[model samples]
Target chain A: MKKIIYLDNAATTEIHPDVLNEMLPFFKKMYGNPSSIYSLAKSSKRGINLARERVAKALNASTKEIYFTSGGTESDNWAIKGIAFANEKKGKHIITSCIEHHAVLHTCEYLTKYGFEITYLPVSEKGIIDVKELERAIRKDTTLVSIMFANNEIGTIQPIKEIGEIAKKNNIYFHTDAVQAIGNVSIDVEKLNIDLLSLSAHKINGPKGIGALYIREGVNISSMIHGGMQEFGRRAGTENVAGIIGLGKAIELSTNDITRKTGYLKELRDYTIDEIVKRIPDTIVNGDRVKRLANNINICFKYIEGESILLMLDHEGICASSGSACTSGSLEPSHVLLAIGLPHEIAHGSLRLTLSKNNSKEEIDYVIERLTAIVKNLRELSPLNK
Target chain B: MEEYSKEVIEHFLNPRNVGEIKDADGVGEVGNPVCGDIMRMYIKVKKDIITDVKFLTFGCGAAVATSSMVTEMIKGKSLEKAEEITNINVAEALGGLPPIKMHCSNLAQQCVKAAILDYRKKHEK
Candidate 1:
């Protein structure tokens, strides 16, 4: 097998060895349920509590406010649906940006059927939303506002602080899907004035099935799941003890070491961006250079299609994703790219390279070399090529 | 990145006969940017034989590979023989594309048929 250079960290990260080690004990000796009253279950309960504390501490929120769920999608659904259903009679209006993940946007769309009005906030060509526009979109009937902290596709980080402030001043609840931003950036829920924030473990080099939703204390949230008394009866499922321990370890390590990790990723990301621009003509970077995530590089090579670029890269053992889901079941390009006013051809050709702290300079250089050749070859093959 | 044959990957990376044919007798363009796959074909014909074929395709790896393969198959063949060039033969020629890409794979054959039809409409007079 060829050596692999994994740059598609946005899809998911490999579980950290430390996180995996912390979780190993739970599956064997500490297998008792946290909900059970037996003495054997105390270790599992302690593991869950420690994880809750770690997640809460990472966001500067109280332990009581952290609620665990399946993953980013579940947390997003719970936050949007929880607020919408809870305040249905007060006001059916909900506002979310058009560039959000399907988790948030789809949830808002689902609410539209329940007589809940949804307003999709548009982003600029650089994928930034104006604070004033968000303020104007707020209405008396608006129950909640959900905008992602950073986009998964373009890596555009929205003005979450401003949006949160606007939501607060209007007395509306604000939820942010920070699935892509949480580990890479330092986030304080109180500082950002966020009412609800979602983060997934796998995105931060932890286990896949566990995630947390930060609901500010005293925020009204209707439960998405019923029956079991777990998660304060908010998300009723048997606790994923091993996954929780892994998430806790992962969050604690990532946040404890975030400054260095992010800085390193940023250096590599900028270098690659510069190298690609210098080597390839007619290529344009997609998102705001400075405002974008430190680990993300979305660049569009003119005339060539994204899937072809990805395929050539794969043949070289370099893995990345087209920001567009074009090759998949959805023929349409990425909504995030389209929302940013990219034409269909440009959007269709967008390639996203999300980095990880583990990526070395050598790997980055090899990727650039292979990628430059691939782009040139594809462009030559493209009819629209210059 | 499903398991594509070496031939498909080969043509995708190094496709043959790219670009447009200036003042070509017949032209066919198929697919939309929305669908994320588009193939434009230009053919030069003489005495009922396709003298030369060229194509410009903007699509996934399979689309480009299929387009290249179809052009190679029907380049010197007569219009009637070229009309029989199916996407299946293109796929088989390239050792098969991923099943999901089979839909966009047909864009090459469709464009070929359209171009031949275009030639017929123009020369029947």
Candidate 2:
């Protein structure tokens, strides 16, 4: 059997066994609609409620504030559009960072057609947004400030609490797309003064297509999906029962011992980063040295494109991702890397290897071995190497 | 990788005629690194017949595979015949690249043509 080493946890994670076990009954025997008022429906309703509670607990939010969505994309769309439309009367301006995930950036772009002014704050060379710049970007009509808790590509953790504080002082609602931050970084919505936040289950060893949005009680955001009374009438459609259950169990397991889980992941991440930089010449470790996700190791190899490296790695039973334009399905390199001031050529050579608890020291060593050879070989085949 | 044809993956994994011809009669370079693909082709022509061809590329799988395939396609062919080879021919020879990767084939064809053009320019002078 081929030995597969899955390292793209930020893209999505393998479901935890415990989460899968908890969700099994919901998909088979206890398959009842949560909206249906019957005894069988009680199990489904209980499952959703528990998942919502788990999500709320992780963010230090109240159960009433949590509303399940399809996933991070939907949650991001809901939060950004909901806040933008609802507060249009108050103000038509929104502030966000340049390095946010496409989920937030595209949503902000879409809002532009509706005459909602947006300020995309630039990040420093290390991909950290300037808090003072964010403060200055805020206008009197800036009704909301939306920034991602962490970047999906480079894994740079933004100063969300500082942004949240600025938004609070300016009397603007703050929303954070925390899809990549869940389980990786500890966040408390209350302490951060975050009015709206988006998170997904798939990033933390849970099922895909299940996520939650946290909305402060007094915040007046309009519902994104409407037709059914599910999710307190904020979101509509039949609940993803099994997914919700898996998310509940996954969140509980991941957050129960966050310190230990992150500590172990950090050791692996740092080791991998250090080894790659040391072993390979002309290799750069992207993102901040610290204040980044514990599991992320983004690097750019000089003189070779990323997809070729990814292909070679894939051949060796390794799974990873890249910020190269060829892999992006669009012919543009990662905006995050570009925003951080990397040249287009270097950005094209970017590789993102996001780790998980399942990864180990041995796997990292093997990856270093294979990666060193791949980089050396590809550089030999590169025209720019001359 | 699934989007790539088996031929593309095969060619990419074992790219042929890689590296440069140090003292080649003609050398051509095309495409930009900004677009994530840059291909350089070197050709050695003897008595109006292509004697040897090699390429070096900095790009994705498609770019490398296409460069490899084009070099193989034009290696022993006459300059006139190699000049007739289009991007379509290169892509077809590799069982077709994805629409997004068609540019790689174009880069390959352009690179070969650029080398041929260089050969012709030197001789024409």
Q: What are the TM-scores, per candidate, against the unseen true structure?
A: 0.94, 0.99
RMSD of each: 2.1, 1.0
Please provide, for model 2 over B73-115, each residue's C-alpha lDDT reduced to its tens digit, 9 standing for 90 to 100: 9988898999899999999999998998999899999998899
Residue-level lDDT tens digits of model 1 in B1-125: 47888998899778888888898999998987676777889999999999999998888878888998999999899999999878888888999878788876689899999899888899897
Question: Which CAPRI category fits model 1?
Answer: medium
Quote the lDDT for A129 in model 1: 87
Q: Which stretches of candidate 2 lie over 4 Å from their true place?
A: none
In model 1, pairs of residues that clash are none
lDDT of 1 by residue, A176-267 (tens): 99999988788999989999999999998999998989999999989988989998877888999999899899899888978888889999
What TM-score does chain A of model 2 get? 0.99
Question: DockQ for each of the predicted structures, in order?
Answer: 0.61, 0.84
What is the lDDT of every predicted structure here? Answer: 0.89, 0.91
The residue-by-residue lDDT of candidate 2 on A54-162, one tens digit each, is 8889989899999888899999999999989988988899999888888888999999999999899999999999999988898889998988898888889998888
Candidate 1 reaches a DockQ of 0.61
